[model samples]
Target: MNMTSYEEMFDEYVKSSAAYCASLFEATEYFFKANAALEATIVSTNTAKTSTIHSIQEYFETCKISLIKTIDLLRTFQEIHTTIPGEQVEVDFAQQYFYIKKTLSCVEQIIQLFSTVRDDKNLQQQIWDNDDFTTYFTTSADSISQAIIWQCNFAKRANLDESI
Candidate 1:
């Protein structure tokens, strides 16, 4: 897809993910409040309150699993193609540069949104603050760097540095 379309998709994905997490948190807060009220009025029903908390925990776990899946889906942004008709396939540096920059911005935003939802300071202190963040940033940066090097070599070999 073109850069504009890719960006639109990325924004939509991030917004949807953030909204989902917000909804989950809101629901969790509501459940906790409800459980608290139950405990206040029905002090003898300890087992039921414990079960309510367990259910809330289970719900959050499921939401986290879903968030991870959507984050993994962001890998599609890096799968751009540069096909050639013959055997000699050259890199499209311009296309790579544009999309790589967009991907980097999207990843940064993703990291910000990812960190806001979680309370663990330890995880927030890590690189990108999410399980896939390190790999995503490193892989994208490496790909962009390689593309730059390859583009420079290609321009030098063709003696078309000015054109590039």
Candidate 2:
């Protein structure tokens, strides 16, 4: 496939990923509201809260997997085009830089929200007290961080400003 086709695929992935991140943020907000309501009603049970945490964790895992796949696709594109002429590659890199910036913004928002959720006293206790949950959450966060780092490195290699 040509660079244009790769660009199209990258665009679609970014759009989808951004939409997914937005939905996850919204869901987290809703979860907070629901938890508050349950607490106000004196009906907030540990089981219900734990279930919600699990649901959010699952969502995080799905997002992480999607990001990793997207990064792999980007790596494949880079490897295949490694021998392309400089001028053409630079043009393609310039376009990809914007897409990467947009993706970084979405990922950063999700990361911040995830940190908030993870740091909540109740959620922290539940996650930390469970060995499996602790490992899962940690692994998910690490994987996502690595994916972000890979993208940043790619931008740097292309001589794009890190500020993006």
In terms of TM-score, which candidate is strongest? Answer: 2
- Runs in model 1 deviating more than 4 A are 1-125, 160-164
Tell me the TM-score of each prediction against the true structure. 0.28, 0.38
| lDDT for 145 (candidate 1) | 51
For model 1, how does the per-residue alpha-carbon lDDT over 37-90 read when each residue is reduced to its tens digit? Answer: 423423333343333334433433443343343333323322322221222234
Candidates in order have lDDT scores of 0.41, 0.46
lDDT of 1 at 11: 70
lDDT of 2 by residue, 1-164 (tens): 78997777666655554554444344334434433442332333444433453454355445544554454455455544553433422324444434433443444444445454542346545444656544543443444444345445644755554443
Taking every candidate in turn, the Cα RMSD to the unseen true structure, in Å, is: 16.2, 10.3
lDDT of 2 at 63: 51
